[model samples]
Every structure is written in C-alpha cells, then in structure tokens.
Target: MSGRKTGALLVLVLLALLGACSPAPECSSHQDCPPGQLCLSNRCQPGSPADGAADAGADPGRDAGADPGSDGADAGADPAGDAGADAGADAGADTGADPGADAAGDTGADAGDEAADSGPGDCLDPDGDGYGTGTSCLGPDCAPDDAERHPGAPELCNGLDDDCDGVPDQGGVCPQANPYLWVFLLAGQSNMVGLGVNSELGGADASGVNNVHIFCDLSVHNDGNPHCLHWVTPLVPGFGVLPDRFGPELSFGRRLHELWPNRSLAIIKIAEGGTALADRWAARDGDLYQLLVQQVTTQMNDLHIAWSPRLVAFVWMQGESDACSSDTANAYYLNLRNFIQALRQDLGVDLLPITAGLIADQPMWPEAGKVRDATSLLADHLGPMDVVETTDLPRHPDDLAHYDTAGQLELGRRFAEAVNALLADRDWEFPGDFSRAQGDGFWRYQACQGASCSLLSWDLFRRYWKNASATVLIGDGWVQPAESQAAEISWWAPWDGRIQVTASAVLAASGGDGTMVSIFRNERLLAGPRPLTAGSGASFDLLLDVEQGQRLRFITDSGSTADGELDRTTWQITVHMSRVAGD
Candidate 1:
C-alpha cells in the first residue's frame, strides 16, 4: 500500500473515466472522414462509410441505463446511445417524405414541356403554282366561292387567276352573239399606218365573224412602206398590213374585236401620209374614190353571207395635206357628202354609219385650228357621230405625225367606246347649214345638171336638201325611209386661205331596206355610202375638206318624199371660220 502503488492505481482509474466521457474524432466535413468513418455533426462516427453504421460513442451496449423510447439501447448518460437516438430520429424524419416524389415531379414537368413543344405546328404549302399558300392564291377559277379564303392576291393586271386551282387568266362570263354588225373604216396618216410599235407577222384570233372580209391598202414591202395598194379584192383577215402585229399596239380592229366580241365586223383601211385632200384618194374620178368603191363592194359581198352586213360605221383621219389651203377646209363638208352618196349607191344598205376623228395633238400638223373648227361644226350637227377628244394624249411620242404605242392603244380603246355609245342610239344628227363665202362666209348651190340644189336648215348647224337626191352633213343626219334610196351629192367651196377635213357614217337599220349616199368636195371624193336601205334610216358626216374657202355647194339625187311633196329639201354643210388673208 505504498505511495507508488497508489499513484499507479489512481492514474488507471482517471484514464478509464476520461475514455468514457471523450467524443469521437473531429472531421471538417463528410469528405474529411476516414475510409471507414462518416463525419456526422463535425465528428467522425465509428462505421463504414458505405453502411451508415453508428459511431463508437453511439453504441447501445455502451449505455449506462435502459432508455424508455430506445429500440434496444440505453438512452441516458451514454453519449453513444444518445447519438444512436439522434440518428434514428433523423432517419424517421427523412422517411416521412418520399425522396422519389420530387424527382417524379421534375420528370412530370419535363414531360409537360415536351408535350407543349409537340403541340399544333405550322401549316403551309410551297413549291406549288405562284398562287400557293405562301404566295398569291392564283387558281383555275379566278372567282372563288369564298374570297376571304384567298387573301394573298394582287388585285392588279398580273394576269393571274388569284384563287387556288389551276390556270391563270380564267375570267368571268362569256360574251353572247350580237345581232347587228358594226364595220369601222380607220384611215389616216402615219398614226393610222402604225409606227413605233413593235411589228410582227402573227395573226389575231378574233371571236365572231359573219364571213365579212377586211380590205386594206397599206404599205407592205419597204421597211417603212409609204404606199402599196396590192390585192384589190376583200380578203379574209385582210390585205396590206396585217394589223395583228405589223402595226401599232392599238389596232382598231383588234380593239373592236375585244370590245364587241360577238358582233360581226369588217374593216376597210386605206390611208397614206403626205397625201393632199385633192389627191387621187379624194378625187371622185381618181383612185381614192374608185378604190374605196371597189373595196366597199367586196365587203358587201362578204356581208351578204348571212344577209348583207349593214354598213354601220366609218372612221376618217386626214388633213395635214390640205390644211395649207383654206378653200379645202370650207369645202370639207360638201366633199364628205359626195362620199356618203357614193357608198349608199354602191353598197345597197340603209345607213352608212360614220365617225370622224379630229386632229389636235401635233403642232406640226398644218392649220390645226381650221381642222378643229371644221370638225367642231361637224360634231355640232352630227348626232350619231362621235368626236373623240385627243387633246389628253401626250403631245409627242417619237415621230412627228404618229403617237406612241401606248397612246395609239388608248386612242383605239377610246374610239371603240365612242362607237359603242353611238350604236346605243338610233337617231342620226347630221352636220349642216354650211355657207363658205368669206373666211366664215355662205355659199349658194345653184341647180345645174339635173335637180335644183339648195340648203335647208333643220337643227343647230344642220341643213336639209331641197329637190336634191344626195347631200353631205358635217356630223350625222337621218335619211328618209333609210332603206332603198339613192342620193348623189356634189359639193364645191371657194377657198383663199387654209383648211382640213374628216368624215364618217352610220347605218340606221339592217333588217328592212337599203339606201345610198355620196360625198364630194371640189375634185376630191372621199368614202361613199353604198346603195343601202331599210324601213328605219341611216346618216353620215365628214371633214373631207380641211381648208379655207369662200363659196360652198351641194347637189343631191334623192330627198324627203312625204305625201308626194318634197317637204324638207336642202343640203347640210359646216365650215371652219378663219379671217386670215385669202381665207
């Protein structure tokens, strides 16, 4: 029992007490734990990291007393038992919620996202016709049942059927056949001959035809043919320049075909530039009147195919030639009357319709005022005639006497519109009461050859023939008993200055009879209305003389046969006023 033995025993007891109270090894974090230990609450627990075993300090057998709630371990005094209880409590807390539930929620949210991405997609068709889903909706039928369905269409001249289907250019209802036939004779200077327009050798495919042929004496051989009257007879399609392509874009016949697709039509064109009003074409005994008669007769033969085609209309474009002579201007109306009479006698139809074109654009055209004044007077008297306004077009396109392609086309279209308007009405207003004494003077026509020729005033600027068979009106005039009648009108005007002339006609009826009317000015003889007649009536007007004159005369071959008494007997005339020196 000595002091050495006592000291050793005390040390042993102290060591054991210390070991019981000490905690497990310290660890910075779970990663700082050894291979077989886990860092729990900043201390290394005694257990394999893989098994999640309890620490040495948490061993149940090392507890001092049995715990009330501990599964099989002491709960008081022993730190190991307390540790095990804490571990169990944490495990229970973790078990209360499903660990996979949050993961499942994330997976479901992801699924939802995928579904949203897979929902309705875009609908469009490409590589189709220009009218596909992405482009304008062109189709086989231009007019669709639902216009809203085809929203991407350009409402312009794209020439596309803006509704989905097949072809482009498919349009509306087809045109019906027109019982009446309208024949327009277009003749003028370079503009009438068609210049500056791209020319070709193709032919037009018009819709309706009453077998009526077209006769033209246009320049053919030369690059710019001046005058070449070949193939004298009326030929199918036509002779001279084929208007289909070898002319300006505004081909009169072509436009007529489109405007009146179902109407029977025949056009006779004989125009030359630089030809004076007193040239052969103007002279009654010259080639102009003779050729016109021949061609008109040929047209009549074709018109007879389905009952002779009533000479419905005529167009005249000239004046630059005689514009230098004032006498020609005043005598224009008288000359025109002679032409109408000749046509009526030759054709044997009721009314020889006429529509005169006035020159007003190019200043290079001599005596434009005289031409305008004369034409204006004619319009004032001629009810059925159409005086188209050309002042709207550009002053010049290229040539001195010709309009551009666009201008020409527009001109043709306007002319067609005017004709259509006139055809709608039946009454013919003839130009008349023309007296060429001074610049705006009066002329007296004394009966010389057969009948007494004189002037009879009717409407404003209109005149009737007294004991005369044929007479010329500036505008349009109704012929008595339109059918089966003949009139030969001769005209003369004293000129001292400058003038210009234009002419046209209209057939009043077709189903019944026939009549004839001729026009003449000095030696110049323009177009003549062949022998035509009908129960109804017909009329005509002309600017056959575009010049200054002093005296004017008219001689007719037929007149008003009412109750066997010549009631209205007189010649109608219109003259452009000019106070120039010799005019």
Candidate 2:
C-alpha cells in the first residue's frame, strides 16, 4: 500500500470518531427554551443574541472582557464598562453559571435563577410577596414594589386591590374595628326561622336596611346536618327558609337599627324549622349547636380581627318541637339552661345577654306549658336577660304553629325590645332625688334627659337610690338604678385648677355595652364612654380644666330603651382636686 493512501485512510477514521462524539440538537426555536435561554449550536444557552428578550433594556455594545461567573449586579453605569462582568453580560439576563468558561464573555444568566439570593431572580420579587414583574420573569404582582398586593390576598379597605381581584375593597369595609358596631346572634326552631310570605310582609327590602349585615345558613333540613349556604349580604326581607319567605331577623335587626340608629348592627342567624333543643341543638359534637359555632367562627374571623365587634345579644325563638312530647317538655328547663350555659362557654362570653321567647300554646305543639314556663323563669330577676311573650303573639291561622306576617314582625320587635331592656338595665346612672352638700362642694345626682342633663327627678331614681357615702366607702357620689336615659352625679369644683377624676361603677348583675362611665367639665363633655363588657366594672380617668365653681360631673347613662329596672349600680367617683405639676 502507498503512504498517501494510508494517510487518507487515517483522516477518514478521525472524522468518523468526531462525528460519533457530537451531541444531539437541544432546542429548535426561542419557544423551545426557558425565558433567558437561547438556541445556540442546537443547545439551549443564555446571554447570546438568541436570548434577546431576556437582554431587553441592557446595553448591547461590548467593551472590556469579564469574568465567567458574576454574582454582582450592574457592575458599572454602562454595560461595556462592566469590567467586573463578561462582555454585554447584563444584570438583567446574563451570567456565567457553567463551571468551565472563557473570560471573554459570560456563558449566560439562568432564566429561572435566584441571583446569589440577592437582587435578582426568575421574577423580580423585590417586595418578597411571592410575586414579581418584568418580561423575563413575569409575575402576578401588578405592584411589584408593594408586598401587600398579590393574588388571593385579603382585600383591604384601602383604595388599592390588595387581593389582586381587579376591584379594590371587595371583601367589606376596612379597619372594621368600630366598637359601636354590635353583632347579635339569632337562633332556634321553625318560629325562629319564620314561614311568613314576603308578599304578606311587604315584599323585598328594596331599600336595604342600612348597616345591617346578615349571614345565614338555614339550608339544612329536618335531618339537622349543616349545609354549605355561604353568603354575606345586607339585610333583605327574603332571608327565610325560601327566598320568598321572611323571618324574625328582619324586624329584629331593623328594630335594633332603629333603637340605636347612630350605630351599625349585624346578625348571624342559623336555624332549622323542626329542630329540638333536646336533640338537634343538643350542645354536643356534630350537632346544630356545633354547626352554629363553627360557621360563626369562620364568619366572624375577619370581624373579630378587624372591628373587635361585640356579640351584644342572643335571641332565641324555639321550643315547638320539644313541646310536642311531654318528656322533652318536662326536661325543658334543665336542658334549656344547659344549652345556654354551653353556648356561653363555647363563645367565651359568660355574661351574654339573652332574649328568650315563650313557645306559643298553639295546636301544633299543644303541650308547651312546661316549655313556656321554663323560658319565662330562666331570668328570675337574675338579669342580663329578658323574655319575649310569644304565647300572646298571633300565630299563622292555617298552620297554627308558624307566625303569620304580623306575628313574625311583632315577634322580632318584641325580641329587640327585650334585648334593649336587658342592655338598658346595665346602664348605670346617678339618682336625682338622692344628693347631699358636703364641705365646700355640693355632690348632686340627676338623670340625663336625652344626652344632656337638666337635673330631673325620676320615680325610679327616687325609689332606688343611695348617697355616695352609703354606696362606696371612699368616694363622694351616688348609687342608683339605671334607666332609659343616662344618669348624672356631679361635684362642684372647690377651686379652679386641672383635676383628675377617677370614676368607676358596677352593675349588680352582668351584661353591658356602651360607655358605662364618662366625665364632663361643667357642661362640656370630656373623655370617654368607656365600654366595659361582662362582670368587669366600667371606669373613667380624666384630667380636665375646671372653673372655681364649675361642675365636674361624672355621668353614667344607658341608651334609650325604657325598662332598666334591673340596673342597680354601685358608684364611686374620687377627685384628686389638688395636684402639683407632673404629680
């Protein structure tokens, strides 16, 4: 064989070896690779012209050669001046992640990389809200700089769309921390749910009673299992069993709104028509009572966090089912008591105010005498409770068990009145007929007419009253029963100066809302209507300016709700009339 033929044979063998070692094509187009990656030599690569989208807004002109891998961002003002990084290697989309690379330019920026875990990522999550912006690392965060705005975030009452749901403030009002916004719970059986026709009760509530929010889950049937009837709405007429039917919550909520027009109201009404206190609402696990607490827990999750709303009242209109049988009716009192006890325990409100309605002695549930008696006797002068007389309220003529339009409406009003009475009874006040002049100042007691005090003597104040010395051993004030209007007990300023009045009062029984104790300088109102719930006494601490003979009055008043017979309060007002600077 010739030497030339032998050399050519060797060349052919080397070409065959190189062809066998070559890799397969990795990508075909820009779409075939990650955002920052490009198709170079049929392989998905980065930092080259193929990865143009990732290099957007970057200076493309090349200058100084750079290191292979760079953890630094935007090394210089100009892309070419980036001697710290490789040629045209942008913080935007170019880096050298490959182990082996030449110093001429960066291999590429990882399209889906967190750049040294600082300042760079597949997405520009600067706010760290798990969202970002930019063409290479596009994200759901419309406001990339803000951490609060994102998908599925809770919509705040702020002007922005916190949840990224297009519209802002969709989840309800923001900073729902208004203490005056009272929440009431309405529960019970068929009568409580009500079967009155909407047409018979004035159709739909088109005007939408203001500030009254309702969350109802009455979809459950006689089986007593809770249903997923999740929805929150402004108070409408047809929130009954059917969309066309009306219930007690309508008038109950409305009456409350009317009575306390200045403040807002809300309700959590969970009921079933045929449930029995002894069975369905047994206060045990997996029952209607559990459903009530569970649903309410979820519903009020935001409310409790935001507004710190109070559960002011619980109105119950039930007992027809238990009344159907003598055994249940006989055990009604104990069972009912246990139910209330369990509710208060679960809700963590031991001093919960309740308005229980008497079961009607209608033909539908004729053996209701025991149940009726139990309801009435639950609050035997041990207040924070009131009873609505349902036995007298008219029932549906045909059904004999359910309340007709008028009956249902009246029932609701009565429930509201009963609740009002209970709350009013806790409002403490100074007695007008009881007072004395001691030392250089006169300690006088009076009832507040509306919000102001003209110093009128009421029969209630005259009948149930005690002087400050008799009420509290340390203070010079008055002890009197709470009435519809707030009561005032003022002390004449012995000398002109700034004084601190530390006043406090206590209702003999539980259940209270609103400013129990407040202070005023002469006729000018000063600090507080300090709200105190439960057995905790209401108190006030105020530093006020007073004239030499000005009236520094300590006032206590329940809102307007006529019956406050049970609001017997002990009063104490200590005035530190003499104080040095900073003392």
Candidate 3:
C-alpha cells in the first residue's frame, strides 16, 4: 500500500479502537467522579493533570486521593504523595505511614488558617511541644523537626531562633548572663483586650517591634493556658482579643522603648472582652483572675530559671462591665484594691507601681462615674498606684464604649509615662492623679481671642463654649485648646531658680489650619509661637530661671492664617525643679 493508504489504514484501526471505548462522563467536580478520572472541561476524562502530589498540603489524611475539599475525602490512589497515605473517607483516613500528620505526626496545621501547597515533608511534631516538626511546620519555626527548638525554649547551640525571639541562638551567647527582660503585666476587660484594628497603625508599626516581646492569651474564659500562640514573639499587632487587632501594649511597649531604648521589654497580657472586675477579676475564686495568676506565674517561672525577669509595672484598664451593674460599681473600690493586692501577692511582687485607666465618661454605662470615683479612692489608699484619666479620649464614631486606634495608642503612652514617673521617683510635677487637674487649682484652663485670655470654670473649661470645643484634657491627660479660640493652661511657679520644662504638642483636628503653640513666663515668651500642622508635632525641653509666684502659662494661638477657628492644639507640659536656696 502507498504511504498515505497505510497511514489511513492505521488511522481507521485507531478510530475503531476509540469507538469501542465508553464515552467520558461529564463532572462538576473531582468528587463527582470515580477514581482514575480527572474532571477536565466538565468531563471525567482518563488523565488528570493534577496528581496526589499536587495536593500534598491537604489535611493529613489519605492525601493520596486528589481531594480539592474536605479533610482527606479522596479515596483515589496518589502514587506521588509522601508515605503511601490513603485519602479515603474510611480506609484512607490516616496517613498510611504515620497517621493524619506527616511521618513524625506533629505538624500543628489544620486545613483552615495554615499556609498551604508545598511539596510533602515532615511538617509534623514528633515531640510533645505544641509546634510542628520540619521546616514546613505551621509557624516560622526553624529546626521544625526538633522538639527542643521552639520559641521560649532554652537557647541551644543550634543555629536557629531557639528562643524564638526572631533571632537565632539568644541573638548572642547562649542565654547570655543576666538577659534581664523588663516585664509589664496588663490585666482588665475589653479595653485592655483592645479593639483597635492593626491596619490603623502607621508604617513599621504594623509589623513586630524589635527588642519588645509579647506573650498573651487572646481567648476568653479559658481555664488552662491559651493556645495558637508562641511562647513569646516580637511584640506585634494582633495580640488583642481579636486575632488581627492590637491593644495599648503596642503603644505602651514602644513608648517604654523610646523612653529607655537600652532596656529589653516584655509584656505579658491576658485579657478578655466584656469581662467584669467585680466578678471575673475578683481576688476570690475568679476564673479569669486565677488564669491571670497562672499565666503570670507560669511565665515568671519559665523565664526566671534562665533570665533575670523583673516585673516593672502592672497596668489595669477594666471597669466598663462593672460600670453597667450598680452592685459592681458600688463594690468597685474594694474589689479593685483587693484585686491589686491579690495580684501583687500571687505574682510575688509587693507595692508594684500600678497604673489603671479610668473609663471615659460616656453614656454607655450610667455608673461609669461611680467606677471612676472608686479608682480615685483606691489610688488614695494604694500609695504606689495611679490612674489614667480618659474622659475625653476619643472612641470609635459608631461605638460608644470601644476606643478607636488613636485612643488605644494614647492610652498606652499615658500608661508608659505613669510607669516611667513611678520608677523615676523624681518630685517632677505633672498630673500623677491623671484625672483632669482642677481648674481652680495650680493648673488653670482658659480661652483667649487674640491676647486677652480669662480663666474658665472647670465645668466651662471641660465643656464646649460659644458653640465650640473647650480647652480640655484629652487622652493621657494632654490638654487641648479649642478650635475656635486660642487657649491657655497657666501655672504659678512654686519656687525661684532654674526649672526644667518638658512639653510637646500635636494638632488634633479632623481638618484644620495649624496652630502656633507658645509657652510664656507671664508676659515673657519662652518657647514657640512655633507652628504645628495636622498629624505633626513639636517637643520642647528647656531649663528656664524663674522667680517664685511667677505666672507661667502654656498657650496656643491661631495658625499663620491667623484664624483660630477650627485649629485644635493638644499639648502636655511637665515641670521639674529643685527647692530654691532656702524655701
């Protein structure tokens, strides 16, 4: 036959063989077909481009079957999968070699919430530590195949993040001598378990901060230790009750670092949403209270062996829940006092400097004032204690009780400052009782149109005047001048001699002309009339000589546009001095 005819004859024979075979059936998904068929173009065809190896990251069951969904639902054979595992619903449920997980049976991964799709490896944890083994384990665990190599574990000579503090091998000598970790303990309800979104944080803040660490229980009401967290990780956003949200810890830790950059800081936080101090945080038989005790004790115990762990501060931001209940509000003072005492006892620290944030006076809780009063009274009784005033702190526009991101950050800064002051032990003058400084007292709040300023009553100073914002104390007790007028917070020099002045200011308006902030010794200008634009700020540190009974004032003027209307200037002024030569 001719070459063409022979080709046709062979083609005819191939056609005949093809016609004898059964037609491929249509399929919506891989599950709709039997083994040996691929759902291609809606048809169960003979060849599947995707084999079991392609789904190696699927649930630890019989991943040999190519299942696109469910935990190892495929029964089809996968020659390419690691360890001849069956993905069958029954017989193939476990990895044939080592149960559901990889060969070592310890990768802490679920089909949900884990990174997927890498070629099969151990990914299992052979040891009992709550982390997976192998490099491909659930987290960024170096030496994942080894149980002794997780975060917070003792730093071995292994070139890994043995302590799991982002750096491998202690970031230096194996657990260097006196790696003193400055510890801060945080306790409270939803406010402490902050609701601020991570995305709201600026630049590098969205990632973990260096040298600052966090170990927290983000869950609510769990009796034992919480899960899904490392022993300790670089302090990052998402340590709040919500996995992706963060609390004041971010700001608090960062501020502490800013204040004393050389010290290594760690924050151990355990907080829940909507928890009450009178009940949930009571010193007696409180589950959360007990858990807080356990977590802190456990952390201290764990670190004390190899680290010089110093508990520097205890910060509390509770009471909103209590504020909603009359009985809780009434009992708040004693409850808080006992709670602090018990925490001190359990943590084995006495007279620890404590800072608690006062709930904002909002309509969410009618008894909020009672709780605030209790905090004030508690402070009077507890010598090394202080309160953070938050009445004017901003909250989410849509939520009455919850603080927004900016509010959360400010709360942290205030807590840091309070703790810093207690530790400094200087007779510096600021608002230790952070509740608004009495207008009738040394710190006076007043308003001015141009140069003529008159003091307003505390009530007028706290409330809007002339249909505009008043000169008021805001988050962390920073005073903000009104948008419609220049404002002043004046103080009388208590002694004669050189005085150290530390002050800062930031624009605090949604939209505005900037403001000119000035500090004057009576009529003598000391600093500023310096301009501050939106989201921008200036800090002043000065040593000025003054006579006793001098009228010193921190003042804000309208911006260069000279329009005081809608220019919000927020500032803090602190004065520190020694007694003059003979009082």
How well is each residue in 1-583 modelled by candidate 1, as lDDT tens digits?
9999999999999999987788877854334555556555357665533222122222211112322223131112111111111111212212112111110000000011111222222111111111112121232212211121132332211112223232221343112212444456666555565543433222442222232345566533223433234322222222223333222213556666665555556666766556545555564664666666676667656655653244556666666665666777666665555554455445442133456667654566556667666666665544334577665654344554655545565666677676666543212112452332111112232323322223333432334333234333222333332112223332222212222222233344444333334443321122232233333222332222122111222323333332111212223333332221111
Clash totals in order:
124, 7, 11
Selected candidate, larger lDDT, 1 vs 2: 2
- Residue 285 displacement in candidate 3 (angstroms): 1.4
How high is each candidate's TM-score? Answer: 0.39, 0.45, 0.43
* Candidate 1 Cα errors over 4 Å, as ranges: 1-182, 199-213, 219-251, 302-308, 395-398, 426-456, 459-583
Tell how far residue 163 is off in model 2, in angstroms. 41
Q: Candidate 2: TM-score?
A: 0.45
Backbone steric clashes in candidate 1, count: 124
Q: Is candidate 1 or candidate 2 better by TM-score?
A: 2
Top candidate on lDDT is 3
Candidate that scores best on TM-score: 2
Off by over 4 Å in 3: 1-177, 221-229, 426-583
Please provide the root mean square deviation of candidate 2 (C-alpha atoms, Å). Answer: 27.3
